[model samples]
Target chain A: MESAIPLHLETPRTRHKRVPDDYQPPYPSFVARYKPSVNRVVMAYFGLQYRGTAAAAATDALAEIAARFAAEGGPSHWDRAQYVDQAGYENVVSVAYWDDIARFDKWFASAREAWTGAQPEGIGTFIEVLRPTVARHETLFSSLGRPEGVAAISGGMSGEVQEHAYWGGMRDRIPLSQTGPMSPGGNPELIRDGARLRVKAHDNLCLIRSGQDWSDTETSERKLYLDDVEPVLREGMDFLRDDGLGIGCYANRYMRVLAAGGDASEKSYGQSWWKSLAALERWAESHPSHVRIFGAAMKYLSTLGPSAKLRLYHEVTVAAADEQFFEYLNCHAKTGMLAAVETVAA
Target chain B: MESAIPLHLETPRTRHKRVPDDYQPPYPSFVARYKPSVNRVVMAYFGLQYRGTAAAAATDALAEIAARFAAEGGPSHWDRAQYVDQAGYENVVSVAYWDDIARFDKWFASAREAWTGAQPEGIGTFIEVLRPTVARHETLFSSLGRPEGVAAISGGMSGEVQEHAYWGGMRDRIPLSQTGPMSPGGNPELIRDGARLRVKAHDNLCLIRSGQDWSDTETSERKLYLDDVEPVLREGMDFLRDDGLGIGCYANRYMRVLAAGGDASEKSYGQSWWKSLAALERWAESHPSHVRIFGAAMKYLSTLGPSAKLRLYHEVTVAAADEQFFEYLNCHAKTGMLAAVETVAA
Candidate 1:
């Protein structure tokens, strides 16, 4: 069934920048394209929050999880990062990706048992898992050499895709967008156990991880980025964090990526949850903050031409309600998905 | 009616570093000490969270609030900062201070009406107002020149305070700590009004803002800080953010201070809410993460001696329930104090 949602037609209300049908992107950009056999992928975030005294214990717990993942049947790939949350607690997070749900379920069940069975005092643990169908997930990258986020699990890059370099290009690239408008349905529900809180997901809950890496830029470009582009980008990010609720943003976190040694790196990303893909698109396509961001980025890119070493990329997912799981132990109610859910008796 | 909480006595289970009565600090530090006539101070945080499209409207609203405060009998001092929240929304926050509650109430009533009466579309507004008795607030600074947070409204800085350079010094500096054990007594209760939610404060809710400024440091010292000190400091901060619930911390946010032009500055701070001053003290004195941070800081200080240009400061307040007011409009359930409260009908 063909939905009434317009496709690539600019109306009087259109505010986003659009390219003509024959327009070509100035630079090559790539998106992840998985194999046909990979019908879906599971992304799981295992988090450890702890006080200084529990550092050793938390580290040990993380190592155990890693070991479990490295077993006979486990996630295909995983990465770790560290950050401090709003409440001033330190967090170590490990993100694992699996192309198959059966494998993920087996590994997760064992890992969960080991993690919750013997959590040491002064440590809080949480798991946020998302299983999005292959058609529902989309990824874009400015460069081809580096693959981050869900792109790490892709079979290969879709060498120079035609959908980018214009507004609504992100939606056009998503396979599921062709079939239907991914409108949100149902409200988030919460269940409480002892010291743990679990949030059941709602359909069409959108998640996006948009990132920037200026670590490889030269002195002038780096200065230009830090002084010009970054400020505008930050302003946009700050706006979304503080007041995007009216536009259907559930929550936003602007985070700095930590290096292997737990030091803050030159890279950073904004991770946000939205009510639906349409809401996110509404903000991105026409929002003034994004326009400023786009202007700054275009100016920087044009000034530097192909020599610009800065990298930009994003991964977006819209998960089905049955394919998501969020559980938090001894954490404040605002942690992750808990913030958007209504608490009910278990 | 003397409380049984021990004062400066080292028992067999002592874990925190202590200084002898005659021991002298190697460097000078200052604390804010208001005049005897000023028995209390009011601090109000007015926040504007908005999407890019609503930026202009939000800015105007903020200006109106400032203008209202500037008019006939407003706050004594006020400052502004911009940040991104967990949900990816951008936030512009204005913090105002008043020496008299009567003056604050008078200004707030007018300001509240102007704010809530006509909030533009695509914007979310919130007010977190706190009034603490003079005896309930304490401030400490490593350097004498720069005054921040509550110190911006202090009569003057206390010259060479002796309560610092020890683990339990923070508690010792609070005047109210002398008479009673400031134990948390009540649960946070929430009241709803249409889209707005108000969280009534509990009895001894603790708030702390600990800041670090390495803006003026030389290359070598800055490297020393970023490499040696910051990693250790961040580890402690992360631990607290993730797992401090078992230790009495309610919430923690490690934030980068934005410059006047909305650019990230060379300063950052960890703002946290705790159950009580005693809970905070226990973590500071006995937590391993904090111990590591203290060691790193001491090493850096000893190495740099008097040449260290990094400035450190913190302000802590143990607020009475009646003195606190938290109200969020069109905000997620987890924003600020709402995360730790129980919701009830209006």
Candidate 2:
């Protein structure tokens, strides 16, 4: 659920505020901190609410059944949390992740039955149902706050700082960067040396990108182009990484493969946490090696196809971090909140 | 991606799969192990390939710009992953996470201009035109391998000692416990005192009861009937925690509220993870407390005017430990995964 709340004031500020006669707010409970093991599995749940009193009944029944099942012999080694709201109106998105697909599959089937069975008459009213979509990727970098000495840097080399100027403006902050090609000048200096952790998961991206045809393969000539594509593709990826451009740094170069049907369906995304936006922006604006490699890669791709049907998006994550990063990992599962600090400050 | 991969190949097989000479296999160097962090944000790109050469060109340009931008100082921190096949086609899903949103946001803006500005004329020729949708949600939970003990208990759970089970009969090696309700006596001995991670995440349930109603308020006449509700809800939650019937023993709940007008239309979701289908189940079978609470909740909700809307969902999680959990967490921004280890090295 997107967050917002109106806490009771010691003094009433708004005249329209109306407190329910029996309103009893749940007390704030302190959550315990716990470090997660590396082999853990996490799940997020997204749900769409049914309209009317029936929807309430549906949710309550679901809650009861779930609680009972847990008491019976369900796994208790993980954390669980939820959010409900009427804010989004007709659309209600419920998302939850599981430690493993196997266990998740079991929980999924049983839960479906319980929910449907509970409201024999009202369960079929859901609109816009979507199947599960999964994507896996790796983390290359992260930045949670402005790094030291960024302001002292000259030009736009402030890396993520520049990126933020553009993206934040789009999100209703302030307009600084215009919507167009970025002029080269400002570029943040890369850490000449530092300990950067790199992690990779199995087939997350490949599985999602499989079967997307950027070039027409319906003809033999188009298919032959594939032969020369491998080396170029590798070079391009290598350049992207070696240059430290980070993913999604470009506005118009977005690429997506069409789903099996002729529609363009894509996979989920990976998370990031750079040390600073200035650092991020510098990589985006001034990387020279990436410029050359990516350009060559594009030229090669154009040989098989033309430029159409493509779109691009740009976002600046001024402050960034993995949702399941160390700080997140230490949060209490039950409350969807941070736990009391033992090793780190809350 | 709903899982369809077979689980029979537990032991690694020879890596001898052949690919067409023209096949552009993704670079293996791009793959890495996953790390868990609490503060990470991902910037992902989804491109539709069906848009043809023009789309490819636009995407190429964006890629080039992104690469060049990286050269500036973005800290090479992006991973291009997930190419999903909807129907029979494919689409690309690239992701990168950051430690801070501000830094990412800055780079994101500049990149946006580069991408949008580079679009070729008549770009719509390659594919259908649809604005891409970007969504952000917090991480919840994740797991790997049969949630804690499902793997160990696979022997009794599966006479043939199969590993995993798919939903219904769709996939191979999946188990029923992970799929649906287990028979009361399925594994009495295995239902020990400690937490047993299951094969699934959330459990969705319906609260069933005879008779129904349309009430406007909890009038004085029904005060006694309402008096018994709170106990039931507490009982259910307590039972799940104490008795160990639910998956991922930890539990939490949230409430959802709509923000009056157009703002509500932009984003949608229910409160907490309970909004999903799986968590709802735990609330049901966990205990009698849930049943009582549900009855009360329904009655109370029914009094929120004739038009009050309510929905239900339940979920249970099976978490993993160590590398497995870390893999799960690093994969998503909002979800947290705890590893599943040998609770007792029996």
Candidate 3:
């Protein structure tokens, strides 16, 4: 594995996170581990939107979809929750994870046919899916718990990793980033026919899901979070949502993770799309918004020390154009990847 | 106003929306008309966030700020609303409009001194302001009532505008876009000292605040919106928030407008930041998410005919680097323009 390149060689740009020779992380963090045989994973979001009057119909639709997933040849792991969207519409979203794209492909065919075949009136249904290779994905968690998102399908969590608790740590965690800078290539293109729209993604399109869980915090810690930290976090999220183009963020959503009964839970997360891993890294490392977030988080963690019950985690993926699939049926023009690409008549 | 350029001349790219010579709008839409003497205006968002326990403190703070505005030198008009942010924290936001920046400057000095001097414990405060020249701003409305945002500072609504019901109409509506392609010219730079961070913005950074109001909708129209249009709109907004990089959107927020008592009102909006007007136009003209939004709106409007009560409006501004100012005090790293630029030690 030895290379001819010298250790002292300095390139104009570095592909990996640079820390001072004596730099050490303030706290230990863990990275999700996957089996060597697992090369690609599929993350799919099945969303169903309904009005209050159509609750029964929406429930029936969701039940049918759940039944299919429970049948043979389904995803390896799946979770569902209910929430109210920004427009105050009731929505039930099911997230499914599959370690093997082939198995997902097999299950998706039947699921798509059954779901699209029966179009329930007064309900909005959509499927947004992504398949990223192992090298293109990265994950970090502050503490161990039942892993969420892509981690649910992972083999286990790694012991404390050395790459975290500092700027550029996220990029340094991504395996692909070690070999080359994941720069975006080409542009997203959309094909439309009638009510259906499909968006073809571009190379190195980056997606990040940064989450927080104060559901298990003590009363004092909860107050500290609600009073001191959460407001700062919301400010950052709002900034990203309203004015985040100059630094390379495309879109951002600060979503409340809802309970099964559709009540706002103690958990929430920010989902964002970036032009490339570099753009995201730039913002995280140097943007004032991120700096403020880091400062507040550090202060909070230090104040509570080991007794801090609040949990934080994130997953970032840079998907190749061919690895992404975005389609909408009877959905709005701004759904998912549709807003990032040009649409043309099929 | 006559120029050497011929009418039939076709440039490499067009700065305005293009429609067939015989094209007629499906429905009439109006643009806000500013007084001839008014060449610029300032929009400021004064926000106060507090926990439930600090409601009284927040109220007092709001009263103090409002009192200042009501005094001798102040904004031309102002409106207030209370809403819950994504983090479940209560926020009271006051939007003030000033036709003159110098007048705002005069008021802001005292306001800043008074507001910042008193750091009310347990309450988080911030100010986000934008000043754009008349040529750099544009506004449109399906039907006007008490106009919101920048329109609140305008003279009145124009008669049925020619640019409506067509792709690229937004660009055509912008007075500056008629002459020049509003492209970004520089990168955002930041300077930080302790808890304070200041961001210098780039040229032609586009800002859009697109709003929807169904507050006065009849039962049937309200149902039509909730059942059909709203879901689609949420999908589009979510798309922009979660995945809007490839088409040039930097950030997008789908926010619910709240009542005076912090209850959700029958109004919402999508506020987004884009790299340039051209990028925005491209998305509006051909992106699937926007296409779906336009389709749904047209269907709703046509279905309800002239009796439709759902109101829609948007304001777009392409600000020069010097025209924009971003500053944060004891704020998180990801606040406002902070997320869109680099931060350096002051």
Worst 10 residues of 2 chain B by lDDT: B126-135
Go through the candidates in order and give each one's DockQ.
0.01, 0.01, 0.01
The TM-score values for the models, in the order shown, are 0.46, 0.18, 0.47
Candidate 3, residues A20-82, lDDT tens digits: the string is 233345567787788777889888878776779888988788888888878877887776765
TM-score of chain B of each: 0.85, 0.26, 0.84
* lDDT leaderboard ranking: 1, 3, 2
Model 2 misplacement above 4 A: A1-233, A236-273, A297-316, A320-346, B1-346
Model 3 residue B204 CA deviation (Å) reads 42
Error of 1 at A213 (Å): 2.1
Kindly report which residue stretches of model 3 are placed more than 4 angstroms away from their true locations once superposed: A1-16, A20-22, A116-118, A242-247, A258-264, A286-289, A342-346, B1-346
Measured by TM-score, the strongest candidate is 3
The TM-score of predicted model 3 comes to: 0.47
Per-residue lDDT tens digits of candidate 2, residues A1-346? 1001101101221111111122221111111111222122333322223445456664665454446335433333321212222122221222233334355446655654443323433332111111111111111111222111111111111112211111111211111111111122222221111121112111111111111232323444444334444344444434432333233221111123223332443321212223233233233322333333333334443443432222112222221123221112111211111111122222
Give the Å error, residue B197, model 3: 41
List the candidate numbers ranked by TM-score, top first.
Answer: 3, 1, 2
Q: What is the lDDT of residue B207 in candidate 1?
A: 91
Recovery fraction of native interface contacts for candidate 3: 0.00
